[model samples]
Target: MIVADKKPIEEIIDEIKRHTKILILGCNECVTVCESGGKKEVEILASALRMYFTNNQQEMLIDEHTLERQCDHEYLEEIRDRIDQYDAVLSLACGVGVQFMAEKYHATPVYPGVNTCFLGATEQRGLWTERCQACGKCILASTGGICPVSRCAKRILNGPCGGSTNGKCELSKDLDCAWQLIIDRLKALGRLDDYETVYPIKDWSTDRAGGPRKVIREDVQV
Candidate 1:
């Protein structure tokens, strides 16, 4: 899932302070699951902003809405008729959703209301850990399903670096050595021989090195 963290209220206020009317838009997807930007969060932020404006004798019109998703055109179209009512939109979706909304609306200013963190898993309530960098390649099959690109401190593919000691990352004692986890996983799976195999240099073009990326599926086209 795409995990995100709420932006500080002060920074958010600073951005939209000049606007008399604003829309606090939320997403019901990943950001909601992560508890960063959902219906509840939108209400909280809107109320806080309203309080700030009211306390300072500023007349501000702040409204809130949550879409099934901000990334899709269908869900975004739900607000088409009412969109022009606001001076600007404070999108509580991920960075991708904010950009998509801006691109679609074009005329309105769209501001991100949260910091896009990473593609991660929910370890527990209120806790998320990075799992994938979206490097456009899958090395998990060779590494017993552990992702080195995201979990490893140095992103070492071959094996653990000399810096790691006692299965802990050199960067921090609390951090587990990703490669060590891989080795243990492989050992448990009775595939320890796979560790001896060397992986070639990763192709950088498949990653963000080539700028924006896209995938097409003609089968699902309109």
Candidate 2:
């Protein structure tokens, strides 16, 4: 899941300072699970904005709506008629969803309400941890399911650098040493020999430096 957090109210207020008519758009997708942007959050923010405007004696019109997904054209189409009524849109979705909305509605200014953090998973109640960096290339098959690119402090392909101490990262004692964890996991599965194998240097040019990446399958294409 993609994790994000809401921007500060002060910052959000500043973005729409000049707009009297605003639409607070929320997404019932990834942001909802992370508790950053959702229907309930949209209402709370809209109410807060109204209070702020009222306190300042400014006449403001704030409307709130949550789409099943802002990134999907079908979901975004649902707001086509109503969105034009607002002077600006504040999207409470991930960065991708915000861009999608902006592209679909070219006339209105779109503002991001949440900061996209990372591709992560919920570890427990109230805790989320990053699991992938989306490097565009995956090597988990050889690494015992541990992602060194994101988990390792240095992102070493073959490592627990010399700085690692007592199964903890040198950068922070609280951080579990990624390579140590990999070794332990592989050992538990009787695959400790995998650690001795060397991995080639990552070719970043093939990953992201070339340009935007895409995957097409004739079977899946319409």
Candidate 3:
């Protein structure tokens, strides 16, 4: 999931402070799962902004709405009629949603309300950790499902670096060594031989290092 953390209220207030009319937009997707942006968050932010304006006698009009998703055109179109009602929008969705909304509505200023963190999973309540980097090349099959690119401190593909000690990462005592985990998993699966087979240098072209990338299936074209 795309994990995110809410921006400080002070920074948010600073951005929309000049606008008398504003909209607090939220998404019911990843941000919602992370408790960063959702209908509930939207209401809370809206109320806070309203209270700020009221207390200061700033004469501001703050409205809010949450879409099923902000990344899709069909869902974003739902707000087309009401888009012009606000001067600017404070988007609580991930960066993708904010950019897409700005692209769809060129007239309005779309501001990010949260800091897009990473592709990760919730380890427990109020705790999330990075899982994948979306490098465009997946080698989970050989690595026993552990991701070397993300979990590994140096993004090593071959195996644990010399820095690995006692199954923990050299970077931090709390961090587990990705290659060590891979070796252990492979051993448990009786596929320890996969460890001896060295993987070739990763193809950078498949990663974001190549540039903004896209995938298309002609068979699915509309």
Top TM-score model: 1
Candidate 3 displacement at residue 140 in angstroms? 0.8
What would the per-residue lDDT of candidate 1 be over residues 149-203, giving only the tens digit for each residue?
9999788898799988999999999999999999999999999999999989988
Residue 89 of model 1, lDDT score: 99
Error of 3 at 74 (Å): 0.2
List candidate 3 stretches off by more than 4 Å: none
| Candidates by TM-score, descending order | 1, 3, 2
Q: Answer with 2 or 3, whichever has the higher TM-score.
A: 3
lDDT of 3 by residue, 84-119 (tens): 999999999999999999999999999999999999
Clash pairs, model 2 backbone: none
The lDDT of each candidate is 0.95, 0.92, 0.95
Off by over 4 Å in 1: none
Arranged by lDDT, best first: 1, 3, 2
**Model 2: what TM-score?**
0.96
Q: Which stretches of candidate 2 lie over 4 Å from their true place?
A: none
In terms of TM-score, which candidate is stronger, 1 or 3? 1
* Stronger candidate by lDDT (1 vs 2): 1
